[model samples]
Target chain A: MNAPATATAQRKTQAMHKNLQAGICFWSFLMPALAGLVLFMAIPMVWGFLLSLSHAQNTIHPGHFIGARNYTDLLTDPEFLNSLWTILVFTLFIVPATFAFSLWLALAVHSIPKGKAFFRTVFFIPTAVSYAAASLIARMSFFSGTASGFANHLVGLFGMQPVQWIGTASPPWYWLVLVSVRLWLQVGFYMIIFLAALQEIPRSLYEAAALDGATGGWTVLRFITLPQLRNASVSILLLNLIAAFQAFDEFYNILGGSGSSGGNIGLARPPLVYIYNVALSSQDFGRGAAGGFIITALIVLFTLVQGRLLGFGSKEGR
Target chain B: MATPMLTTPVTRRQMLKTFVFAGGALLSGCARSDYIDGKLVLTQWYHQYGEKGTFQAVHRYAREYTRVNPHIIVKVVWIPGDYGTKLATALLTPDGPDVFESTLTQAMVEAGQTAPLNDLFTSQDLADFNPRDIALNSVNGKIYGVKMIDDLGLLYYRKSMLQSAGMQPPATLDELMTLAAKLTTPQRKGLFLGNDGGITAMLNVLPWSAGADFLVNSQIVFNTPRTVLAYQKLQQLNQGGSLLMGAASDWWDPSAFTSGQAAMQWCGMWAYPAIARAVGSDLGAVIWPPLDAQGVPVTFLGGWTAMVNANRPHVEEAKKFLQWQWIQNRAIQTDWCVGYGFHVPPRLSLARTTPKLQQPVPAYAVNMLGKYGKATPPLWNAAMGSDLTNAVTNIVKLGQPAAQQVAAAADMCNRELQRELE
Candidate 1:
């Protein structure tokens, strides 16, 4: 602080030298991680981009370089468009419902006076169980088209009609089955995150609000709780969004080709399922790869859009 | 694959000095033709059959095959899910299986994945097998694999239900509807048609039976009054109120028929085992309902055939196995079928003459066996089974009209056919 301007100017070069020296000091520690990121993530990102632009996969055969044709076809294709709407509707249905349920559960557990940990664990056991297993069980529970499954048994107990949960419109019932299983298996993990975020807010803010007149519902939520939860909500939103897009394994297992006589309840044919149908079922790798790349792009774009809207990855958040 | 790990990654300078040492080691290993080692292996992949007895065949053949050849060992893999993709992928690699089994198809034969057996077997010998079974293996007069079995889809039913209703199995779409209506009630719906390729498959088969070819010169002529009749009747059978409950009913086990939940089921002969297992005694199968005026029953008969891999190290040895499968294979067929319990031998001679198919399942299903038998309709892939199933399911589940759905579905079939064939 006592150094003169001319001396400060001279010392700045030495300061720059020190910054370089510090970076060099950390070089060995950071090099492997950096190299890994480049070799795996960065390289694959470019490769996927290249694949998205082309129409070939898993073979040496040359593919058409119809730059954005795949994307355009995806945008225009009726089935693809229907799937987009289906996914968008699914995200809308599941995301808010899941967020609301998880948040409610989290707040309930947060407010629980005794044995909150046990309650949390109990609530999360379904989450810990693989969604595939849960969905299979869930499918059985709903499979009471003729007084066989739990749903029909329960309905019969109450003198109510047995309903077909998955035997509806093609695209609709499929997603309906998917979202139900998805939300059941997912809401708990999000609840835990929200609960942790809820706990992170200082008690002083609440106490101050109580002391003042800002204890109204909206005031407390807007001023204190939401402000506190800004980070967790963004993270959960991004995670859930990406998960919704990349959802394959559960759907693949549940609504697979191995149904009772390979029936019409083909619910799992999401983008990945469709891709599998194309590549494996029809032996059209180019088409499947195109679908995969489209899904990946949708995921990335949706993630970024959600992040940008939530002020995530921004300087202010940091 | 394991030997590469034995060598160290040395610098080029060091490698120049150690070249002789590495070369000497490679030469020694290469020269070792250790005949006594139990390492000469043949790999085969098959879909899991009853209690995996088909898998047991691999071990049984290995041990018993010693009477013929003592130097061979076999490894069998029950390809987990979607055998088509796994087989196709494996065939592409240089280190693929030595022998495998798959349903032969003209397109698949054309796809070049199936190895042509024209050099091995004479045409006259192959023609002796059922034409339908051979149709799958033949592409441009070249055979790709041996016909392992002859399977035909038939309607398995509770004879008691049809008797109680005072109606026999119908021969046309009209009689089926009347019978379906008679059997329908809130407590017990008539049948489980299921949503598989049957929706489209029936269209292909019945039309052929009715003298309506679904396609001519590669263009679809699938739509017709009889086809529409099939569609309408399909709708009526699937209608919500009295008959079929909903699309989900399709997935209820066909064994439910013996349990008496479903009065009837349309399924493959493969289901006989499960039905036999479920029922205390042998079950029954009727020919696909509503036979044509001449009483001709049509169905899709198909099966998987054993194939020798082109890249197999023991291709010649594998061919010997294939040849052995045909040599007095009738007894092996009966043994395998009876041993598996649910299966009847695919050979016409064995199925008819042997007591297995004729052993009085309840007035002798073997009587119905020939009556029910029909060639498999040409199919590109089995997924059509699911897609058509979905279409019918969609009609029932979504409350869409059955005839229109059938029409749209026939159109979809045409599209998919064009998609594949082109």
Candidate 2:
């Protein structure tokens, strides 16, 4: 009985010693990342939140506490309101389009038996291009309003006159330029994601579906492939929606001119651009911070609603 | 298995140690650069200039200064793209440059970002400097910046193109319209004010040329009948299809004129050398032609001034460097203004003495600038400038009537000015 009791005591002590070692290892692994997260992300977020509450006019530092005034002013500001609306319109148009285009491209690449890797690489190459570089190419070469621009040259081939792509205001050609560049730059990334999800889909499912008369292309895609990609689709949709709403670079480089004074907040001014102008250009940091929070809240609300409709993050099936 | 597990831990520990050492070395490296004993390091910033040899010239000047003063190091930071916004943001931080060059705006002055240079300049210095340039950089009768160079913004036309079109350089708004129409061809447009439908460069000068000023007696007077007429004329120019809608660059650049994209271009005098190189002796400049024979042709004076940051840790050292570089050293000043780009020296004595100023094309521009040059008012801040620009956009691009846009802009600008004053 004494031997058994001593052995049990020794086992308990060893277990506690093991637990202590595990804890140290866990913290050691997490320390570097956790320190960076706190220093860079957490602190700035808190500082920015405080700035949103104050009357910080010219500087980033918080001034007199003027709670809710910046937020309230945004409700009536025409430029800010227009910017919000512009982003909404842009997201509405871009998200679904990107979804359809990327999915279609993914489907095409997956079905191709020959040179599948080659085609995949070709489609994904644009994801490596920087947004600023892409926007400049769009501005200076492709969608330039001049007769020599690639878009104009393309239109000329169709027997249509050279269109003023960036300069024209009536028909809103800037939207076309903005949307096309974003799609060209981003579609490849989403397509690769969809392709990975497609590859993960079991071959047996298609065989089973084929037995059930799902032989046609549309039938296979509709009855088998899409339902299987629900998780990836949701993620891509959310990311695309958020990115579309936060658009700045292409619009800024193409439509809004560059200067220390900032560019014109004309047509296609997204919420981020408006906030940037308010904070950096006008030096009204309080209002800018408030606008930033409002936009974040909007994005959150949109994601929540989208999730609810799509039943994402719900544990119903398993 | 025991040996492998033991080796993994040892390797991980070695990796962690390496990271820690590397981080400490980096931190020490960053700290050591600015903390040298008994030496004051002054960081001076200049906006990116398009003129050739500008970067090298500024570096040479800084090097010359450090050679003379061993105890102080003048580190010149050349900022590219969006200098005003970047500088404003930097000035808020403790690590901002000690000295910089920029236009003195009302917002900058009110924010207490600029250090007053009253003690630096005496009565004789004030008298010798161009009074207008000095006045532009002063707030409440205290000078804030020393002028480095005076830039002239006006119309630069191809002389051969104008002559071929049977047009002498336009002397009035009416003549400019006729000349523009006559110069239009299948390949090239008549005039390119800017890519943004001429609102960027021509907006301020148009109203000013019509005897409408941004502020008269500290009250907004930009919405006068004359200004409305000027806007209407601009609208007509846009509607007439003679204005170049898009170019490779903006009105501030000479690219459109040099590339033969437009017969005439609105640009700054800094591009004169480039324009002269591209178009040869065919380049001729004129101020924004007057609204009528009764009015005067106008050239907007767009220049940069060197100022010491009030929030800097080494304001005195920075000021001393600025004085030594641009004020006392006449040779460096001449090189800065004339070596890289064609700019009028802000000092009356220097402008008169520079041999380059005696050249025909530069002489013409200098003479015109002296005669019809205008400085933006102290009351006309960036916000006000943006408001006026928006008004111009509505009138010219969106086809909104001038009177309503002008009135709305005037009201907004006046409210901002009042708020700023309070």
Kindly list the per-residue Cα lDDT of model 1 for residues B374-414, writing each as its tens digit. Answer: 54333444444434555555454455665665566566567
Error of 2 at A213 (Å): 2.0
Inter-residue clash pairs, candidate 2: none
Candidate 1 lDDT at B336 equals: 64
Q: How many pairs of residues collide in each model?
A: 10, 0
Instruction: Score candidate 2 by DockQ.
Output: 0.42
Error of 2 at B208 (Å): 1.1
Fnat of the models, one by one? 0.31, 0.31
Worst lDDT run of 10 residues, candidate 1 chain A, spans A259-268
True contacts kept of 2: 0.31
Regions more than 4 Å wrong, model 2 = A1-34, A157-161, A260-265, A316-318, B1-32, B35-39, B216-218, B293-295
